[model samples]
Target: MPSLPATLLAFLSILSLVFGGKVLVFPLDGSHWVNMKVLIEELHTRGHNVTVLRASNSWYIKKESPFYTSITVYNSGGIEKELFEEFSRNILVIRRQKRSFWTKLKLVSEVGAVFEEMHRNQLNLMGNIFENKDLMDSLQTAKYDLLLTDPAVGGGFFLAYRLGLPLVLNVRWTMHGEAHFEIAPSPLSYIPVPGLELTDKMTFVQRVQNILVYMFSKFQKARTVSKHYRSFCEKYFGSEINYKAILQDADIWLMRNDFTFEFPRPTMPNIVYMGGFQCKPSKPLPDDLEEFVKSSGDHGLIVMSLGTLFTHLPEDITEEIAAAFAGLPQKIIWRHTGPRPVNIGDNTLLVDWLPQNDLLGHAKTKVFITHGGTNGIQEAIYHGVPILGLPLVFDQPDNLSRMKVRGTAKLLDIAELNRTMFLEALKEVLYNPSYKENIQRLSKVHHDQPMKPLDRAMFWIEFVMRNKGASHLRTQSFRMSWIEYHSIDVILTLLMILVLFCVLIYSIVKCICLKVVLKKKVKTQ
Candidate 1:
């Protein structure tokens, strides 16, 4: 009786041990880890044991963390810090050139080459993992409840299959293209392909352009990215298991986008939209930063960050942006890692990093100047901050395009950026009340969801764990051949039957006419 409380605590611990599942995560590195870490923490809070697989040279994923135990895989060659930095430098250079069809093509080619190399690197790492008998044995013996991964790379897919674990994808992109296109039905007519920067409402010409771009994407996937993965699959998983099928076999896709940020498109039962899941109410800023922000008086502060990968723009570009900021009455907080710009003003604060979500949620924060990464866009939407966008690389332009179409943002070309243009764009966003009202409206809709995005995601993850897999919700379309999936073979059969019927009818009519002509001849003789 004296130790009743202690006894209850022990029982609760036992209960949690019995009920909590063991999740093995093979996550993508860099900004993707930010999203995955959120889920890992949530799972840990719910008493689940998490083990993360990380490359030894990973930029972001830490070997030590309070929430999850990390298993460091040595000699794994994936996208390294140097590769991204080099690629970013190339992109900046290419974008600074005169805009033309050839220039745009060069930019596209540069991106394709970089991604292809990344995929190849990931495949090599996956092969190493497969060859490691000790690692394989350890993974097999651990008896993981499920495999949670980002499908941007193919390693997790192969590992999950090898370990016979139920797979759940924390995905927005696969190796080939958008995750939805990989599993769900994406009509080119209505669902604009990524990188096209076209909206769902497309004119006839735009649709044609969409189809051409879609074909090019498919060709690139088949020729470069998918070929490597397919070869790896055949070598390891056997000839019978298609790499595409392995990608589509995921139990669930925890999409990092919601309708608020994405255009309306066909989705799947297993596709869970968890956009802005990582966002929350802003905490109080540091006293110094708060004081600086307050110094603006009635003029609110503007927060600017170009996301993680491209923290600092070219020197000339930064100078132009800094000069533009200097002219503004509102104070500026910019996250820049490079050398200080010469035109820096007293009102501007340059920091290596800032609490982006916290600043966006600040009531006095009026405008968000960004490179339009998905995470930044979602945060701005959650906090209802209008955007003055300078999209740099990858999907940044496309992301900003979506916001521009929604009238919540204005896009500026990085190549043509100058002090005057930058200033004008900032003024438009600041003075144009419509931008603020629209973003606020979207924010309201985002907040009015039935369940919080993160909670919903956690529920689905646990749901898959309890059910072993959500195969019931997964579509079998991936198993079908292209001909079968599109009903082309069936259509051809139907066409053949119709042709035979018509030919039979024609023959019968011809024989009847010939017989009638012979009878008339016989009667004449």
Candidate 2:
């Protein structure tokens, strides 16, 4: 039987593979990109069809996330974990900021942009959702086993839900309590109280952090903030919209953050920890750049990059930055998008963009001065280089502040702070062996994780496909009541009990009054 009909058997095997195999890998890229494209490139090698359907039409990501950019993955576990621990150590900073009325007003004014991003998914957020949906439609021409997407856009998750396919939401930053709301006694989603900052406790500040992260990473609030988005999606799909489809359709959710950084995993499954997904030492830099960095010699080289987005710094900030670097003996390589200062000093070099990961990986590099992007932080850790985080806005300050507390980086408020103070901070990092030592320790912890995050994520994706879309991994919380999910029902029950007790007391008083009236009448008669 086996010898007969060789063509028939060959056809049957091929048919089986076609009917049940093949994965449509979707790397839904967008503007203001990170190393996600690099992840997509690597994952495509697994004999799966890969399509990068997300558009980076925006100025920010288009320039940063080129299809041909070189990428390297670092395995620095020690420094990463150490940095996270350092963040835990400084819980009191964001915690005890007991604001006066005036201070609260000022704080609100300072953080106004952040608050706006939170409640309303304004700016380019609407455009992003539409683009993501278009990409899914294009990909849907063929069936996909699962969708691997960042949690920001959320359209991919909706696609998976509609197609009845398994999906994974890669968490780019900490997004706490977005899943539930009736926060009683705690903001944490069940993480133990003691390990709040380090591993488990949400506390109020962390909860706020969670909100900030989600808002800044492309606003997801389509109803109020993005009525245009809701209407557009409705027009296109002809259905009631899913406000939280981003977190809901995820059969598996991969967090780019780790337990070392935030509260520990609390009752969430099909969740994989791959926080340092982009943390790694990449390929070597060009010889010229290496030689330039090496030429700094005894003074050492300082990398001053404003990262991709905020490179368009104000002239005031630029002049201050130049003045500050002028004081330091160390040579500064500022990642600038504007004109270099007239009569540029011998010790400073300004470039529109430098190969960041490559420079960080180099030995000649002394310290990193960056805008506190997560990818940059991971790269610095991988290289075991200390940082001087000059965070501008968004999650930059928070990320940098975490690093600063970890003893790897010192924060400098470059916007308003003068040049003298900036120079002093740089000097401290340059002369500080403690910063280097701490970073080295953290580097080890960051890499010492149980498994390579990317591989783990790839395995889950494959597992879902092989299991014919393991939808069971998705949580029932997707359909659960806000009261049940947030546990507000319990609070309501307590309120009801209190009300009953009050009613019982009132009834007892009324009964006593009636009795008194009856007794008085009888005595008089």
Candidate 3:
């Protein structure tokens, strides 16, 4: 065999790279970057081009033309629903602060109504998806083949639908649960329990308000999703569609769930399970960070981070966390993004940001006090570090709830933060061999998959794009109406009819017997 010349080799490499495809990933969720930061880099190394479109948080781009073709929205504060969302978030914060059931119910109801009205106005979310025209144009100009998205917050899904490219939804930690799975037509309630954000000891009124609010939002998005689903079908593929059809036709679905931590879903060729995408050790910690870890040595460090969104934490909560950390014998490194926790002692370090995954991988790192984000859980498990989950909102509680049951992590109430509880939890996690054993055990399971998630994700994407829509592979179940999707009532009706028929037959037999007895008595007389 002749070795190719260097020029020929370079030319062939470039040719092979073209068909390898490019992914247009829109990170609408603030953590989209945090979650996919590693995955995209990996894809890039494997002869794929990855371009990130910054997402904007708004229903529509008010400006006719913008600087970038794609918008990445989150923490940009451009959300069209900003006023209403703030109101809703405020309701939770104030309710937690005031501790009034009636007041909370009233506020929740009002917020739910606002959600409905917002839907009526045809506003979905204020993000890149809502105003992704430039991305749509790129579909015509650029050879981008796939739209990779977490899909909860961005315009990538909509643009993918519009461009006739395959759409992939990454099950990044449950921002709102799997309800985002329904493609927005049916309802947000379509999301499974694992994906929902539920309150503890909720009242009936609270539940009513919660359902109403979610319905209002779901219905609002349904109109837009349905409208786009139909329009994109004809424009891109010369087809028409409904929500279920769009959902079923998705080329690839990536979930953060893994066999390591949870029960398995029946595997699908179209689905790639990549639950710990966030936790993969991608890079070496900087010299500064490595030195910090080396300095800890055997003393063992306890790491704490509230995750990205809670930078606006009240001073009181920060103070409580500080008190707890100060009381601990172990060194504490808190990823305090906003105001530093009050009164830091010598054993604690307050940094705006740290290499979270690298720190977890350190031998000196023992215990993790985390906000219980799925990303953090994957990292903790990856490094065999036990965790104390102090969940604040959304899926944090659920993640902790499941992890605690799995025995890899323990839970501490966010409302009940203090020195004793904090110190005790940290000490227990640091000293306990069982937590480490459990995490390592789970780590094996999480890694036991046949292939890494990206390979599977890429394959399915290319497969669908080549197939020009895998309509043949889809199940007819996708066409089912809402009535059929929830068929318990229909089953109950059939059962009731069967029972009534049996009762009627028994009554008829009793009447005939009574008549026969009467005739016999008359004849005897």
Candidate 4:
């Protein structure tokens, strides 16, 4: 006969399987996949069955994994590597130009066009999926407990709605703008919008500028991105279905940020902050890397990386950076993939990739040189490392601006970068003790939470699965019209009523006064 403990263990395993939920993940590729994979691995560990929907030409998402089964859809042309590369090249060239009103206007227009094309491609893919009867039937028959996705792309929102599944978002942004602006109450008077690079406490002029930028972004979004999704919704769904409203109706938002990194702002109950969820303590470095770190001795190390997309700068810029690194006392580990710079320093070690989070956590690490991606910024904060930021494009400058305001980072304009400027900026971050103290304070606050960010995210995901939906947590404000939500209609109605009451009182008094005046005149005669 089998041992009692062995039999009990087997029975418990089966029970866990019975209770496990099915999660259908519609994910964005590239760095977004990096964090989504972390969440998928944790869900797998907890006995959930995860199925990922990926594009046929995906850059980062793998076809097979033990954690989840992937469903590859035929992607025509949307969010490909070449597209981003071209965009990056264009942005760099524009940024290198002298700053002017035209330069800024051109940059904004380029960004709007690029995002519009990306979203259009995503919508086309979703349309194909909907048109394919066999695929649609299989997806429907799977009986998934809920759909989890990153709202940076809109396909997930459409898919969840079509399947009638509770939607959960792995989000810092949506198709229109920041997730909070779409779902939560954002007062622009305090909550600075993205791209403006303003802090919470702004001067009167800055606040006025903030409102203007917010309005401009809305206008740009309406002109460029909204029409495509509007048509897509009308074709598949009824004309009455509002795509933006669907985003607001999502069951849970696993926001990839928290107050430690973000300025304090009004937020919603369903928007759960999971910043640094993917960050963990350092592990032992590979043998060669460890040997290099040991060679640095007491001077510590400077780690440099420009996120996933832009691996290297232009040749001259790279040479300038390499020359600057040569002058530093600290050993350097830089993630560079370009042709070796002739001015490359003996103290610098160049690699195609590095263990980013693990390296940031190392005790010998003194400063981080980054492109200011959210993931990299959070990891730096988690490790209490100060930053020398070279913000390239998109939200990089904005994100670095926040870090600069917090006194834990210094931002350098890549457009005006030279060896001397780069060297001075690096020295400033390294020699400054206040930068270290400020980042460590943030790290302490980030670590002092009741539960780890990953765990909190898991609880909400499972909670949605157990209940089939988190409707109670979701506010119905999305269903309200713009005029109703802002109470503009109510205010106008109250003003009209007051006006009518005043008119009536004035007419009655005038009639009584005239009658009394006529009677007095007749008696005198």
Candidate 5:
């Protein structure tokens, strides 16, 4: 028989396997729920205790779902609806406005106000949640092992910092903005800002514009948003914690992007690319969807959506799209909202929602008509579907720009869209074998990994928990100031030395010339 100590040790090991580490996740964007959902579910399946703190009015994050334990942190019922409505209106104005730099800037300023309001509301919501001493005490007693948050919402980082837990950021979009640059090196000379739509190969003027815009955005955020956020942290946490330092101290950054889809840029060792982590093999479609797809026969199918936010398009734009689809032989499956267009096509199927990924994975899915959201693009890429992009706003244009460069997609400005343009773009993507060929080639690269993206993300998450924050993987640059990180001080010191040397050489030359002149005068005399 085994020794009692050895048997006890074996039983403890089994217990450890049965009860994994506890994880707390705060997902910011409702649209981003899909990205975090898979990781959260997988962790729960692997015996980890996962708790998701979600807004009560979230479009996703069902409380009844048994996937994980969900705690409602905020209960602002109408705020989200009002914010989305205002956002939709702003988008309409932007789409109708003349395309000019000033016009775009003006629209962005107007939209900025809406976002500012949303931020303030979110802060208030967070404040309400934190003020509940009972809930706070309960959470504190639970003693979570780590915190995974989407920092885009602005409150998650502060909460994580307050809890004194290992922080892991889930950036569901491509890394950009001030917080992203503070941790990773994003050179303005090449890597485009998320909304700017510029590619890696920027012209001289483009580079200058990019740098100016980047600087202006950082300055604006510091001036306007930073103070409010700082005050919130101080008010709730009862300490003046430097949020930037907290961000830098983060254990891991799980980005929803791949280098194949994005421009090459410097990434820290702790930054892991978990792109397509939510993607999976197509499940059997719902009966109606399966029948609708089968109705296409050999004509093939096109799937169109503007994702969760922009599904309610303007009437004229909707009419234009419907008309365009009406002319096409291929059957159309559009996920749309609002009143149906006047000219609804016979071949088109309009539903409030559809299983997008499953439809994309279908054999008949020839092309994806999308707003170029990262998740949607990743899904299309995973299924090897060519894209006809109608880029709406923020990062959509940039995503499509990359796809256009890759020859896997074509872009159309939603502001300038017409039936003819839409039809031409759609036909080109459908008829051109190059788009399909390119996407297929890239899909192989996307799938050619040692482990699946979800597995990789889970491994890193567990690794952080096991090692208590993977501090060794953190880059030394995170501790450096911006000037020091860029070596500006070194460059300035070298320039000063070079200038001093030049001045000394000039003084020596002047003395030599004068002495030579005096000698010549004496010799002549």
Candidate 6:
């Protein structure tokens, strides 16, 4: 005996479930496929239609899933692949060199140029794909409800703008980029920029260095990347849109970081922390791997992986790592891609890949040696395993630096790594009960949230759709320029006022002194 209104509301709810939204996702890096897969699958299970536009080399789209649609974009002129190859070569050079900080900075500047070239190629590919009449017709017919993209990839933002869809930025790393400042308050005073490897508890000198670095990064972005991105939009979209302003228009920011691990900073309501979303229930180890772990007995185990990109290490470095592992009593499982090292001992097992999360979850696991990729670090944190980090490049140094400060990890410079140094660091982490205790405490904090990270991400995504872009959540600062946002103009005005007041007081005092002198002279006469 329900009322007509109640019956109609129930019907509408059913209708909404039946006809869920269509979401288009543009992932930046190939490694991001693993992370995006989790969110994409969840959205699919919830009756939402999901489509991913991915590169051909993307390992995430192995076989088509029944849950979502996939479209592969070609490399076009092989430029993207070439740029990646050049980048890998440069990394090898940097890894082998024993250079000063300034020398390393110069090397990285060259690498940044490579990145710019790669970005241009990606933009060209995106432009060609979006401009295709057939693809455009099909996309328009599908009528996607929202666009989810990695802000690191400028092309995705341009595509979203062209399609006239609400945009959600999904950053797959803990490190927020320049675009983040436009949406949230990321003060350089305390929050160190990623890649600097500086901690939040910085000395006065370090703060000054941090400020200079931040300004330099801003200048670099403006001088190089932003202009190209703006040009791309104008050329393709036929509109002159401010690139940074487009970032502010984003509906939500799905950042892959937890506050527990990061420095405390101001975050906007629209930014959601979906860290550890990729940390799934550990799958059963393969038969041989399980047997290997069982054979290790009381000595425990050590798992080493330098992530997808850093899989191939130099032979000398590999031999050093092998020598360290050989000295350890624990069984070692190393993920490596290059030729087998000559020094790998009987205690070590080498493989093309390891079930990283599953191996970390093993009870026998003692410590994780990693490249300090955000995914690997988060996974290690989730499993309560201590880390010995060989941070290679980009945010790896910074990520490991934070972990070291938190007492859960130790970091070593890859350029200076030797067998003795590696072994000493490993022994310290493995023997120290404090590292285990600290990591366990952090793991608890990470897992103690009310809702799971994936569920939280899903809720916010649906919330954005429900509210139609969630414009109310945006801050007024989003529309402000850098000077206005930081209130530099206001500070300057106050300084000028103070100067004028001081001048006025000095003039008044001087006039009073002249009058006293004149009165004294008159009395003498």
Predicted structure with the largest lDDT when compared to the true one: 4
- Candidate 5: the clashing residue pairs are none
Predict model 5's lDDT versus the native: 0.82
Q: Give candidate 5's error at residue 207 in angstroms.
A: 0.9
Task: Tell me the spans in candidate 3 whose CA falls farther than 4 Å from its real position.
Answer: 1-18, 55-77, 80-138, 141-143, 172-176, 179-244, 263-269, 282-284, 338-342, 482-525
User: Which lDDT tens digits does candidate 1 get at residues 1-525?
Assistant: 659999998888788678999999998888889999999999998889999988888888999999999998885565678878988999999988888989888998898888888888878877888899999999999999999999886679888988999999999888877888888899999899888789999999999999998998888778878888878999997898888887788899999998988999888999999999999999999998999999988999999999888899989888999998999899999999999999999999999999999899998999999998989999999999999998877888889999999999999988888999899989999999999999999999999989999999999999999999998998888888889999999999999999999999999999999999999999999
521, model 3: CA deviation in Å?
Answer: 20
lDDT of 2 by residue, 351-402 (tens): 8879887777777788998877777887787678899876654456656666
TM-score of 6: 0.88
Scored by CA lDDT, what does every candidate get? 0.90, 0.58, 0.61, 0.92, 0.82, 0.81
TM-score for all predictions? Answer: 0.95, 0.68, 0.71, 0.95, 0.88, 0.88
Candidate 2 — worst ten consecutive residues by lDDT sum? 70-79
lDDT of 2 at 306: 67
Candidate 5 local lDDT, residue 224: 60
Pick by lDDT: 1 or 4, better one: 4
Candidate 4 TM-score, true structure as reference: 0.95
What is the Cα-based lDDT of residue 418 in candidate 6?
A: 94
Instruction: Please provide, for model 6 over 1-525, each residue's C-alpha lDDT reduced to its tens digit, 9 standing for 90 to 100.
Output: 999999998887677668788899887665766787788888887779899887666544653778778877765552444466567667867866786887568666875676576567677778778768887778778888888887665677777777888888777431125345656677778888766778777888989999988888778767767777778767765565666667677888888887767878788888889888889768889999999998889989999998877787878888998988888788999998889898888889999999999999999999999989888999988999999998777677778888999999988887788999999999999999999999999999999999999999998888877666877777778677779978999999999999999999999999999999999999999
Give lDDT tens digits, candidate 3, residues 57-132.
4343321222223434343433244564465356446534543567545654654454344322222332333355
Q: In order, what is each prediction's RMSD in angstroms? A: 2.6, 10.8, 7.2, 2.4, 4.7, 4.8
